[model samples]
Target: MPTEISSPIQGSLVAIVTPMHADGALDLEALKKLIDWHVVSGTAAIVIVGTTGESPTVDVDEHALLIKTTVEHAAGRIKVIAGTGANSTKEAISLAAYAKSVGADASLSVVPYYNKPTQEGLYQHFRAIAEAVDLPVILYNVPGRTVADMATATTLRLAEVPGIVGIKDATGDVARGSDLIRRLRLLEKGSGKRFGIYSGNDDSALALMAMGSDGVISVTANVAPKLMADMCRLALAGDFAGARAVNDTLMPLHFDLFVEANPIPAKWVLARMGRCNAKTRLPMTPLSARFEPVLEAAMRHAALL
Candidate 1:
């Protein structure tokens, strides 16, 4: 277990999309440019190959390359947290170990989707990954996709694991997120084990930060990194009024970005901005043109255009 992992990252961390060429090949040049853009735009961290990055569509070698490329391009300018999770424990461990090998700052292990593991099983799953890798592990509990939730108690237990250092609470239930924050604070009072709590829900990030969450692992940040980072900066600094102002401006963009499924709207927004190609792996598609004007107007209003 590496106690040397710095105080968990704060402010907005973007789950960046993996850029691909028109031929469907990994666009390494575009990928490096995106990584550089995040660093320049004040993104606190960059999570490569996460859900927003279309992790499910990528094979293991591509996954490892994404992490390695991101870390290389970031060049210690920004923290790189790799999405090294899978339903299989062995595969997850291998990915996590690869993340460590490639010098990633941390690993985001999302809950096993489609499998619906019990609380005990969830704990064991995360604990095994933490023990297997020497890097800090942030549990990702997105019930929306996983179809299963890792309870606060389970997260608290995993907090005891030497390498399990934080969680990305995407359940979107602010009360539950607040409860988990309170619980982690109480547990840390005695153990000296600090477990960071980051909201995976872009909508509830401000509220969660108000309740003592460290920051957010944001999907919205992929396009609006500066605004998202500024919001988190304000909230973390106890400037709720300032944060709310930024959040309010971003509200329309946030809501509309999910007009379809995640990456669809997101990639569409990026395409409109000319940032990425807007190409997503199958089972996902481009945002409908009917919604284009709607998102474009929202982006204009948000001043992201």
Candidate 2:
């Protein structure tokens, strides 16, 4: 077996929501407040403009503004990780470069969506970004969204690429995650290179971490920041008992947030908590009224109510 992958960028990294106004304008003040909340709530990093942040809908200018605003306002209170993934290799490279220029600590790049590239295509896609950018690139493999599952072997190949620091495994398959972690440990032992393994699934985070995942890029943290942060901290410290206690409260929120396709329910919950307004872009609608009570119950269960 391989040894541990010691990375400082560990703990609950929140895949935060992009707050918007009633007319679908970016509510930047609300965004800054959310960042502050995460900072105080013990969240280790803020992944802005991510899937949860509606990165797909935001225009190019909006994207750059979001990254710039996050980096400027965060002011090193916490790590600001810009979501710079684009299906186009050139676009991904440009975004990553912009993130680095603006002082974003790192960039989270997802698998190329819609193209359904082969394993080699995936490797080249990511390798290109690593070569072109000086920033740390954390690969995000959410096959469910991208429709392109990155095999363990392909991930291992990319892990060796310079500037490619880690990955957010959103596949939600604990067995696969465990196997990858073990192999990565072995790789690290030989290469003396450490790659951060972060779980993108909030519900399954503890399980992956139990098998040695470094941390999580969590949607649940967008709502229950303190509890999520506490769980990650306790679990990473080998106190599963304490982590589970915190996780039990967050478990319900985890499923509820996704009940309406990410930022929908998440934005709604935050608005109810007076955190931000519940406004999503055109293609994405507000949380269905039917699920509001259900999510509210979950919020209450987690004491966010």
Highest lDDT against the true fold, candidate: 2
lDDT of 2 by residue, 204-301 (tens): 99999999988999999988888899999999999999999999998889888888787889888989999999899978987888998999899999
Clash count for candidate 1 is 0
Task: Rate residue 257 of model 2 by lDDT.
Answer: 85
Please identify model 1 stretches exceeding 4 Å from their true place: 4-6
TM-scores across all candidates? 0.98, 0.97
Among all windows of 10 consecutive residues in model 1, the one with the lowest summed lDDT is 1-10
Residue range 1-305, candidate 1, lDDT tens digits: 45435477899999888887766678878788878888888999999999998999888889989999999988999999999999999999999999999899999999998988999999999988888788889999999999988988888888888988899999989999999999999998999877788999899999999999999999889889899999999999999999999999888877888889888888888877888788887888777889999988889888987
CA-RMSD of model 2? 2.9
The alpha-carbon root-mean-square deviation between model 1 and the true structure, to one decimal in Å, is 1.1
